[model samples]
Target chain A: MTDLDLSALWVSVQLATTTVLVLLLVGTPLAWWLAHTRSPLRPAVEALVALPIVLPPTVLGFYILIALGPHGPFGQLMQLNLAFTFTGLVIASVFYSMPFVIQPLQGAFEATGTAPLEAAWSLRASQWDAFLTVISPIALRGYISAIVLGFAHTMGEFGVVLMVGGSIPGQTRVLSTTVFEHVEAMEYGQAHALSAVLLIFSFVVLLAVYILNRRFPIHAS
Target chain B: MSRLVAQFDVRYPTFHLHLDLDIPASGITVLFGPSGSGKTTLLRCLAGLERAPHGFMQFGETVWQDETTGRYLPLQTRPIGYVFQEPRLFPHYNVRSNLLYGYNRIRRDMRRIAIDQVVEILGIGPLLERRTHRLSGGEQQRVAIGRALLTSPSLLLLDEPLASLDIQRKQEILPFIHRLHHELAIPVIYVSHAISEILQLADRVVLLKDGSLVGVGTLNEMLTSLQFRGSFGSHRVGAVLDAKIIGHEPQYGLTQLDFSGQRLFVPLQPSAIGESVRVHVLSSDVSLVIGRSHSPTSVLNVLEATVQEIREISQSSVEVLLDIGAPLIAGITRKSLVTLGIKPGDSVFAHIKTVALNEEVTD
Candidate 1:
C-alpha cells in the first residue's frame, strides 16, 4: 500500500473508534429514553434520530456541513470552523452511524422490560446500580451488535465525509474517500487492495455479531 | 406491635383503587382478592412501585410515603424485600450472584440474615452454582424468596410468588414460605387470589373487591363473616379451625385433629402427631341434626354446638353459624330450619361431611 493509502486506513480506524466511543457515551441515554419514554414528543424525537438512516448521505452531509460551518448554529456555539477537518469527518460519521448504534440498543432495552429493573430496585439497588448491574448485562447482545454495526458503518462512510471533510490528505482523507480517489485516477490496483480490505473487514465484523448473538441469546429461550 | 398504615387512591382511565388499611407489622398478612380487584395495585403502592397521587404509608414509625407531608421514600430506599410473581432472576447471573445482589448492596450492619441462613431456609444451597434459567419453577421461586430474604428487609412483599407455578410446584414451595414466616421475624405482605394459599399462610386477611377494601380481620373472622363471604366467593365459604394432629388411626386411615378440646377425624395425612394444622370445613359440607346421635355413619365428624346466628345465603339455603369451640358454618335448606325449628341459641349437632387438613400450614 502507498503512504497515502496507509494514512487513510489509519484515519478511518481512528474515526470509527472515536465515533463508536462517543455514541456509546451519549447514545445510551438517548436510546434508553427512546425505549421507555411515553412523552408526546417521542415520535418527533425518534423520527429526527432516524433521519440519517433513510435520507440520502448527501442530504445529511449537506445539513451537517452547513450546521458546522462558520456562523452556523453549532459553529457559532463552538466558535470554530470545523468544516474540512478530521473532527468534521467524525461529526458526520457520528450522524451517519447513529441509527446503527441506537436501534439495536433500544430494542435490547425494550426486550429487557421493566420487571428485572423493578426486582432490582426492590432488592435495594439504586436506579443507576440496577441499570449497570441488571439492565446492561441482560442487554449484552444488543451492545455487541451496536458496537460492531456502528464501527463497520462508520468505516464505510464516504459521501457524508466527502461533503464535510473534503478529502484533505493526512487530515481528513479516509479509506473510502482514498479508494474513490484511486478509482477516479484509474489506479485499479490500489483501489482493489483497499476495497478488498473493507469487504473483508465488514464481513468479519458482521460474522462476529452473529456468533455473539447465538452464544448469548437475548433470553433463555 | 407496630402496624403498617396505608391510604392510597389510584385512578386510571377505566379503573380506580381507593383504600385505607391498617395492617399488623408482624405475621403473614394476605392480600386476598380476585383478578382486577386491585390487591396487587395496593401492594405496589405500599412498595412504592406504583405512585398514588395522594398516598400515605407508614411502617411503625418510619414514613414510607406521605403525599400530605410530601415525604415519599422510593422502593430502593424503603428497607423492604419484594418477591414478584415470576422469579425475575437475572439471566446473566448464577443463583448465588442473584441472591447476593441485594445482600452486597446493603450496609454491613444492615445485613441481619446471613447468606447461609437464607440458602438453608429456602433449601437453595445446591442451586448456588447453577444459572437461574436452569432452575425448576419451584426452585426458582425458592431462590427468589431467598434473594429477597438476604436483604434482611423490614417487610417482605410476596405478590403471588407461586401464581405462575403448577399445583404441584405451588405445593412444593408453600412449605418453604410457611417456614420463612415461622423462622424470620420480618413481616410479610402476601398477595394472592387463591383461597388455599390464604387458608395455609394468612395470619391476617385483607379482602379487596373492585379496587375497594371489603374487610380486614383475622383469617377466622374474614372466613366466617357473611359480609366477606361474598368476597371469598361461594365455593370458598368455609370455616378455618386451628387444630393439632393428636393421633393417627392407621387401621381406618384416619388422622385425628384436636381443635381446642374437640376432636375431628380426617383422612390420614403426612403430618406427624403434635403438628399444628388448619382444618377447613366448607359451609356446604355441614348438616344440622336436632340431637347428638351415636349411630355409625359416613360422616366422621359430629360435634354438638349452639347456633349463634342464622343468615339467609340463597333463596333455598340458610347459613347456620354454629359455635362448637370454634365458629363453624352450616349451609342447610331453609325448609330444614323451619322443620327442625332451629334458631339462634338452640343447641344442635353439626354433621361435617368433609374436612381438609392444611398440612402445609403447620409451624
Candidate 2:
C-alpha cells in the first residue's frame, strides 16, 4: 500500500478509537437514564439519540459542520474553528455512531431490572457502589457490544466525515474517504484492496461479537 | 423487650393499607396474610424499598421513618438484610463472591457476622466456587440468605424466601431459616401465606386481611383464638401448643410431650428429652364428647376440657374453643352440639387423634 493509504488507515483507526471512548463515557449515563427514567420525555430523548441511525450521514454532518463553524454557537463559546480539523472528524463520528453504542447499552441496563440493585442497597451498598458492583457487571455484555459496534461504525464513516472533514491527505482523509477518492479517480485496484480489508475487518468483528455472546450469555442468572 | 413500632397508611388504586404494629424485636415475627393482603408491601416498607409518606417506623432506638419530622433513611443507610422471594444473586459472581458482595461492603469494625459462620450455618461451603446460574433454586436461596447475613444487619426481612421453591427445595431451605432464628441475634420479619411456615417459624404472629391488621399475638394466643381461625381456612384451623419432649417411647414408636401438665403422644421425633417442641393440634382432629367416655378408644390423647367460647362456623359446623389447660379447638357439628346440650362452662373430654399431632421445632 502507498504511504497515503497507510496514513488514511491510521487516521481511521484514531478517529474510531477516540469516538468509541467518548461514546462509552457519555452514552453510559444517558443510556442508563433512558433505561430507567419514567418521565414522558424519555421517549423523545431516545428518539433524538436514535435519529442518526435513520438520517443520512451527510444530513447529520451538515448540521454539525454549521454548529461548529467559526461564527456558530459552539465555535464562539469554545473560541476555536472546528471545521475540517481532526477534532471536527471526531465530533462528527461520535454523533454518527451514538445510537449504535447507546441502544445496546440501554437494552442491557433495562434487562437487569431493579431487583439486584435493591438487594445490594439492603445489603448496605450505596447507590454508587451498587451500580459499580451489581449493575455494571450485569451490563458488561452491552458495553462490549456498544464499544465494538461504535468503533466499527465510526471506522466505516464516509458521507458524514466527507461533509464535515473534507479529504485532506494525511489529516482529514480516512480509509473510507480514501477509497471513495480512489474509486472516483478510476484506481479500481486500490479501491478493491481497501474494500476487501474493510469487509474482512467488519466481518471478523461481528463474528467475534456473536461467538463471545453465545459463549457468555448476557443474563448470568 | 425491644420492639419495632410502625404505623403505615398507604393508598393505591386497587388496595389501601392502614395498620399499626409493635413487633417484638427478637426471634421470627411472621406477617401472615393472603395474597394482595399487603404483607409483602409492609415488608418492603420496612426495608425502605417502598416509601409511605404518612408512615412512621422505629426499630428500638433508630427511627427509620418519621413523617412528622420528615426524617427518612434510605435503604442503604438502614442496617437491614432483605431476602427477596427470588434469590436476586449477582449472576456474574460465584457463590463465594456473592456472599462477600455484602460482607465486604460493611465496615470491618461494624461487622457482627463472620463469613465463615454464615457459610457454615447455611451449609453453602461446597457451593461457594460454583456460579450462581449453575446452582439450584434451594442452593441459590441458601447463598442469598448467607449473603444477607454477612451484611451483619440489625434486622432481617425475608419476603416469602421459600415461596418460589418446590416442596423439596422448600424443605431444604427451611432448616437454614430455622437455624437463623435459633442462632442469630438479629430480629427477623418473615412474610408468608403458608400456615405451615407460620407455625414452624413464628415467635410472634401478625395476621392481616384486606390490608388491615387482623390480630397480633403469640402463636398459641392467635391459633387458639376463635376470631383468627376463619382466616386460616377450615382445613388449617388448629391450635399451636408449646410442649416439651419428656420421653421417647421407642417400643411404641412415639414421643411423649408434656404441655400445661397434660401429656400427649406424637410420632417419634428427633428432638432430645427436655427440648421444647411446638405441637399443632388441628381442631378438626379433636372430637369432643359431652361426658367422659367409659369405653376403650384408639385415640391416645383424651383430656378433660371446659368449653370456653362457642362460635358458629357454618350452617352445619360449629367451632368450640375449649380451655384444656392450654387452649384447644374442636370443629363439632351443630347437631352434636345441640344434641349433647354442650355450652360454655360445660365439662367435656377432648379426644385428639394420635396421628394428627404434628411436632415442630420452636423458634
Candidate maximizing DockQ: 2
Per-prediction TM-score: 0.92, 0.91
Tens-digit lDDT string for candidate 1 (A1-221)? 99999999999999999999999988899999999999999899889889998999999999999999997899999999999998888888888999999999999889888999999999989989999999999989889989998999999888899899998888899999999999999999999999999999888878877987788765541
The best candidate by lDDT is 1
Tens digit per residue, CA lDDT, model 2, B146-200: 9999989899999999988887788787767877767887889999988778877
Worst 10 residues of 1 chain A by lDDT: A212-221
lDDT of 1 by residue, B329-358 (tens): 998999999998988999998999888765
Q: What is the lDDT of residue A132 in candidate 2?
A: 91
Cα displacement (Å) at residue B201, model 1: 2.4
Docking class of 2: medium
Model 2: pairs clashing at backbone N, Cα or C within 3 Å:
none
TM-score, chain B, model 1, is: 0.90
Q: Which stretches of candidate 2 lie over 4 Å from their true place?
A: B272-275, B287-298, B302-307, B310-320, B331-349, B355-363
lDDT of 2 at B362: 22
